[model samples]
Target: MVTSIASVCLSGGLTDKIHACAAAGFDGIEIMDSDLTVAHESPEEIRALCERLGLRIDMLQPFRDAEGVDEDLFADTLRRAREKFRTAQRLGTDLILVCSNAATATVDDDAVTARQLGELADLAAEHGIRLAYEALAWGRFVNDYRHAWRLVQLADRPNLGTCLDSFHILSRGHDPAAIEEIDGEKIFFLQLADAPDLNMDVLSWSRHHRLFPGEGSFDLVTFLTHVLRAGYTGPLSLEVFNDTFRQTDTGRTAAHARRSLTWLADRVATTDSHDDRRIPEAQCPHAVDFVEISGADLSTADHMLEQLGFTFRGSHHRKPVRLWTLGTARLVLDEQDKHETPHLSGIGLSVDDSDRASARAEALGAPPAFRRTHTGDHELRAVASPDGTQVYWNDQPAETWTEEFTGGDDGDSSGAVVDHINLSYPWQDFDEAVLFSTSVLGLDAQASSEVPGPRGLVRSQVMRSPDGVVRVPLNLAPPTAPTPPRHVAISCQDVIGVAERARARGLQFLAVPANYYDDLAARFALDTAFVDRLRRLDLLYDRDDDGEFIHFYTPTLGDVFLELVERRGHYDGYGAPNAPVRLAAQRPAS
Candidate 1:
C-alpha cells in the first residue's frame, strides 16, 4: 500500500507549509489541529488556500480527551465536537480523529470512553463525518491499535473507524500482524511515524523523539504489509512529533519527507511481494497517497523531490510544508526543528539479495560510522547514503526479538533490496546525481520532472532497482530558492477548539480578513449561525462531498510552523484555492 504523513510531524507556520508539502512529493496531508489554532484565519480563507496549494485534507485530526470523562467534561467535549463538526463542514473535510483519553482524563473506564466516543461518532455521522479513534503512545488506556480497534468494534457505530499509528502501535511492542485480522472498512486512517530506538517512555518519545519513517526502528514495511493484507486501501499519513525537526530549514525538511516516502514505498513493494506471506497485488492497497516529512531546510527539500523523480503535486503556498508526487504516492516534507537534525537526515535501507526484502539496510561496501539502538519492537542501524546523508535502517522485528536484544533476519529478510531514498544535490551536481544513482548505486531510472516557482524551476530524477522493488529520488533547485525551511501539518477533529485552547495557552497567531467570510456566505448556503461562529473564531473553510475542510495559520520559528484542520464529509485534498487569501493574510497589515 501507499504511505502518507500527518502535518504535525513537520515544523513551520501555516502560510508557508502548503508549498513545502507540494515540493516534498506527498500525496495527501493530515492537517494538525494545532497549526490551524495558531492561525486566526476564517474558514473560507483556509479553504481557499488548500485549493491554491493542491493538497487534500485527508483527515482532520487530534480530537483529544473526548472519551472517558466526567459528565461535565463530556458535555464540554460534546460542545467542542459540535463546533468542530461545524468547522469541518465549512472546510470540506470528513474524518475526525478521536485519540485515546490522555493522562489528563481522570476516568479509567474503557467502556465509558467507548460509549462516549460512540455517541460522538453517531453525532458526527449525522453531519456526514467519521471519527477515527486513535490510541496514544502514553494513553491512560487503549494505547495499542488492537485495543483501539476493539473499542471501535464495541462502539459499533458505522461512523467510527480505527487509526493505525505506527509509533503508538509498534512503539508499544504490539504485533502489527493483528492488522491481518481487522476488516479494512473499519480502518479509516493510518498515521505513520518512526523514531530512533531509545530507552525512553513512549509519550516522551512520541512528542520529542519521533523521526521520519526509515529513520527509526519501526518495521513499517511489515506493519503496512499486514495493514494492506487486511484490505486497507487508505492513505498512510506520517505523524512524527520530533523536537529537532522544528527548527531546521523548511525546504530541506520537505525533501527529507519526499525521500522517506520513496523509501517506504519501495520497502512495501518488496515486503508485499515476499514468498512467505505473499498476497496478490490487487488485494493490496495502492502505494502511499501522502506523507508529512519533518526537519529543517524544507523549501529546498521540496525542490529535492525532483531528484527522486517526483512531480510537484501542489501545496498550501501559505503553509509550512510542500506536497510532491512519486508515482501515485504523496510525500509531505516538514521542518519543525524540534531539537532534531538540521541536515538531510532520514532512514535508509540496502540489501544483498534482491529477492528477500530487507527491512533494514545492509552495507554494500564499508560500513559508515554509526551505532545501533533498541526501541520496543525493533532495532535501528544508522548509515550514510551515497551522498553522505544520515539515513537509518531498522535491523530487527518484534516477533523475532527477545526482551533484551533486537536483531535482523539477515538470511530471510536480507538481500540486495533498496527501499527508497530522497537526497539533495548541488545545482552543479545535478548531472552527477543521475550518474551516481544509476551507475554507482546500480539503480534503474524511473521518471523525471521539473517544477516552476517564484525562485525558478527545479529539476529531479528517480532511480530504482531493476525489479522496481527499490526506489530513490534525487532533487536539485536553482539558485533562487536555495535554502530549505522547516514545516509541518497535523489532522484534528476540532480546529476551533484547538484554536481556542492554543489562544488560552498564550500562543501567538497570524490574523485573516473578515471580508473573506462575507464573500463566502454568499457562495455557500451554510447555517448562518455556523458561519457567524466560524467568523468569530476566525476559522476557514472549503467544501466537497467529503465534507468541509477547515484550516488555520500561525507564526514560524526556526523554520517550523503548525497547522490544524477538521474534515466533515468525504473530502480528501489540500485546500489549494486558499493560497492567495492565506498569502494576503500573511502580508503585513496596511
Candidate 2:
C-alpha cells in the first residue's frame, strides 16, 4: 500500500514538509494549497525537489467552494479551478481535492451542484487533472459521503470522483459499511484521521483535537477493511488538522505520522486472514520485572528506599548497579553513568517470549538498546522509548539475574507490588509516546482525561496490558508549564500500616492541606476517625461504585517520587479526581 500524508499535518514551508515526509519513509504527499501559496519555490521547483527526494506529489489540495453556486459564481470558480489545474500539472500531480462548500452556497439543489462539478471536471480535464470532491462535516448542503458519491455519479464525468475522508464520514455517525456498495474505481482518494470524542462544534474539534490512528477512539481497522473490501487500492493518506502537529517540528511529526500508518496497516492485515501481509502478534506482558534508576550519585535514592521499607539486595558483581526490593517490587539503581543526573531510566517487563517482543518492536522502527554484561548473565533485550527511557524484555526468572548480585537473596519483604508507573512528557512528545506504547509495546490505550494544574491543564492517558498486570499512565505536561518528574506507585494490602511504619522510620510525606479533609467529608459519608487519620498522615482517598482507593506520596527525590496505595475491591481507575489537589500541593510557592 502506498503511504502518504497531507503537508498541512506538519509545520514548516512546502519544501521542508516534503523533505521530512520523504525522510520518514512516506511514498507521497498531498500538497496543501496554502503551503504552496506561501512557499518561495515555484511549482516546477517543488516537483523537482520531490523527484530528487524519491517522493511523489500525490494530490494538490484543496480547491474549496467549487460547487452549489449561481452561474456567475460558478464561472469565477471555474477560473480559479483552471489556475489550480495549471499549478497541479506543473507540480507533477494528476489529482486535486475539492471540498464541498462550507462557506458560501447560493444554490442547494443536487442537480445544479452536479452540473457545476461536471463543468469544473471538464475544465480540469483540459490540463490532464482529476477532481476528487470531498464533503466537509460542516458543509452547508452536502455534508455526507453518500450525498457526495451520488453527486459524483450524477456528474458522470470521467475526471470527477468522490474522495472519502474518515473524519467527515465517521464524525457524523454515518455507517461506513455502505462504502462497500460503491464501485472501487469511482473512489478517487481516501483520507484517514482519528480523533478523541469531544462535544464541541465539528469545525473546532476537527481543527484542533484530531489524533493519529490507534491513538484515538476511532475503529480505523473496520473502516479500512470496508474500503479495501470495495477494491480501493489507492494510497492510504492522512489529513489530520491538529493545532499541536501544525506547530511541532516537521521531521518529528512526520516520523510519528508514518508510524501510525504502519501500525494501522498491520492491524488491518491481522483481522483479515485472506490478506497476504502479516505483522507479529502483539505481546502480552505478565508482570513488571524491575524499574531501573540511573544517576551520578544515587545514595540519596538508596537512603530514601531504605526509609520506605526496602531492603538492600546487594550490588551486581560485574556492573555498578544495586538492587532493592519491597515484596515483588524491585528497583535497580545504576550509577555507572557519572555524567547524568538522577532519573527514572529503565523498565523491565516479563513476557511469554522476550525475543518475539524485541523483534516486533524492531519491526515498528524502535532502535535496539545494548547493555554491557558478562558471559554468564541472562541477556535482557531492550529498546529505547521515544522519551529516552529504556524498556527491557525478560522471560527468565528473577533468580537467573539475582544470583549475579554479591549480597545474596536475603532482602526485606514489605508485601508491596508495583501498581503502576507514571511518565511525564513534553507537549511535543505526547502523541508520539502514545503511538509507541500502543503499537511498539503492544499496550491498549484507555480513556484519557484532563486535570487542572497550577500552570494549566495536564492531559493524561493510561496504557496497559490486556490482563491488567502492566499499567503506564502517560502525562502530557501543560504547554506553558515546566515538565514534571516521573514517579512510581507501589500497592500493598494495607496502605495505612505501611504509612505508619514509614513515618516512624522518618520518611517525609507530601503535606496535605487542612481543607482537604473537610471536602472529603462533604464528598463521602466516612467515619470521622477515618477522615482524621487520612488528614493526619497526608493520605488522599477516592471511592467509586466498585471500590475505594487510598494513597499517599513522598517528597520528590531528585527527578523521581514514590506513591504507596491501597486498593479495596475492584478499583480499576487511578484516582483521577484527586489529581488536581496533588498537582496544586506539589507546586512550589513563590
Candidate 3:
C-alpha cells in the first residue's frame, strides 16, 4: 500500500538519497548495502535521518552468493549472512534481499539449496530478521522467479519468503499467473521495473536499460494485477538500475520514480486490494483542438498558413494571438518572447473533461502551465510537459474561445485537418516526456524508430490516441546539439491542390533532390506521369500494403515548418521512411 524506491535507482550519497526520496514523497527506500558500507555516517545516524525524514528502511539489500555452494564456501557465506542480519537490525529494517547465486554454484540439487537457505533463514530469525529471496535473471540455476518460490516453499521457514521483481519475471517471459500459486503472506517484498525490448545478454539489459513504468515496453499493470490477486500487501517499490538515471540529477530521478508509481497505481486500481491507492482517472483526448506557436514575431508563419489555404479567423481581443483554421484544424500564432526562432510552445487537446485531465496530470507530477485570462475569456486548463511545452485540455467547443477574435474572413479550407505534431526533446528529458505524454494524455506509445540524419540517428517515439485523433512523434536529440526544428503536419483531402494553391500564393516549398524521385520510381510501382507530378512539386511519397502517403514540407519559418499530407485509403504511418530525405533537405537551414 506504500510507494517506495531502491537507492540503486538514483545517484547520490546515502544521506542525499534518503533526503531526496523523502522530498519526492516516497514512503520508504530499499537501501543498497554498498551505499551504507562506504558512508561517512554510521548505521545509527542513517537510521536516525530516516526517522527524522518520516521514511522507513523497507529492506536492506543485498546478501549475494549465500546458497548453492560448497560446504567450505557455505561456512564463509554463513558468516557474511550473520553480519548482514545485524546490520539490518541496526538500520531498523527487518528484511534483507537475498538474490539467487549467480556464480560459484556447482550444486544443482534443489534440496541442498533449500536446506542451505533454511539454515540461513534460521540465522536471520535469531535477529528477528526476514529474508526475501529473489531470482536474478543471470542466476546459475534458479533464474526464474517460480524456481525461487519453489525453493522458499521447500524451506518452509516463516522468516524465508520470495520477492518478485518485474524485470526478472517479465524479461525471462515467465508466466506471472503462476505467482497466484504462492501464498500472499509468503510474498514478503515486491520490486517493479520496466525495460525496453532488447536483444542482448539479460544481465547487461537489466543493468543498463531499465526505464520507469510507463516509459518502457513491459506490461506492469497486468503483472501487478496477478500479484494483487494473490493478496500481497507489501510496498510497491521501484528497483530500476538505469545508466542514465545513475548519472542524472538525483532529485529529478527520484521525482520521476514517484510519478511512475502514481501512474501505475491509477492503472492498476481496478485490481488493487486497497481503494485509497488510486489516483485521478485519465481520459484520452478526442482530437487536437489547436497548436500554438510562439516567437518574437510570426509574420512569416502567418504568410505560410495563408498559402496553405487556411482561413484567417481573427486576432485575440486582449492578447497578441491570432487564429487560423482549415476544416477541423486550428493553429494559433502567439507573438510572445519565447525566442526569435518560432517553435511549438502550446497544444490544446479536446477531451471529455478538461478539469479531470488536468487533475490526472497534476497527480502525475506535472506543474501547472501559466496562462493569462480576463473575467470573460475562456479559461484554458493545461499542464506543462517536461520540456516546458504547454499541454492544454479543453472540454468546450472551439467557437467558445475562437469567438473572442474578430477581423479576418472565415473562408473555405477543403476539409484539411492536423495529422500529427513532431516535437523535439533533448536526450536528458526524453524518457520523462514519454511517460508524461502517455500517463497524462492517455496516448499509446507505438514502435520506436531511429532515422538516419545528417548529424546522427534521430530517435522518434510515436504517441497516438486510441481513436487515432492525435499523434505526436517525440524526437530525441543530444542536449549539446542545436535545438531541432518542430513541424505541424496537416492532413488534407487533396495535398496536390493545397500545394498548388500555396505555390500560386508565392510560398517556397522545401526543394527535394531529383535523386529521391529516381529512388522512389525504383521502389514503387508508380508510372512516369505520377512520378513526374510528385517530382515537379518536390513532394515525397511512401506506400505500404494498406495505402499510399503523399506529403510535402514547407521551407523553415524561423525554427518551425509546416507539412501537408494526403493519405490515400488507410495509410496510418507518418512517412517515416521519407524522413531522411526531408532531414537532408533541411540541413542547410539547420
lDDT of each: 0.61, 0.90, 0.90
Clashing residue pairs in candidate 3 (N, C-alpha, C atoms within 3 angstroms): none
User: Candidate 2: misplaced stretches above 4 Å?
Assistant: 412-414
Instruction: Write the number of the candidate with greater TM-score, choosing between 1 and 3.
Output: 3
- Superior candidate under lDDT, 1 versus 3: 3
Q: Where does candidate 1 have its weakest 10-residue lDDT segment?
A: 279-288
lDDT of 3 by residue, 492-529 (tens): 99898888888888987999999999999999989999
TM-score, per-candidate, Cα-based: 0.50, 0.96, 0.95
Q: Encode model 2's per-residue lDDT on 431-486: one tens digit a residue.
A: 89999999988888988888888899999999999988899999999888878878
> For model 1, what is the alpha-carbon lDDT of residue 60?
75
| Error in Å for residue 443 of model 2 | 1.6
The sequence of per-residue lDDT tens digits that candidate 1 reaches over residues 58-150 is: 777788888877899888888999988887777678988888887558887778877888889878988899998888878886678888888
Model 3, poorest ten-residue lDDT window? Answer: 270-279
TM-score of 2: 0.96
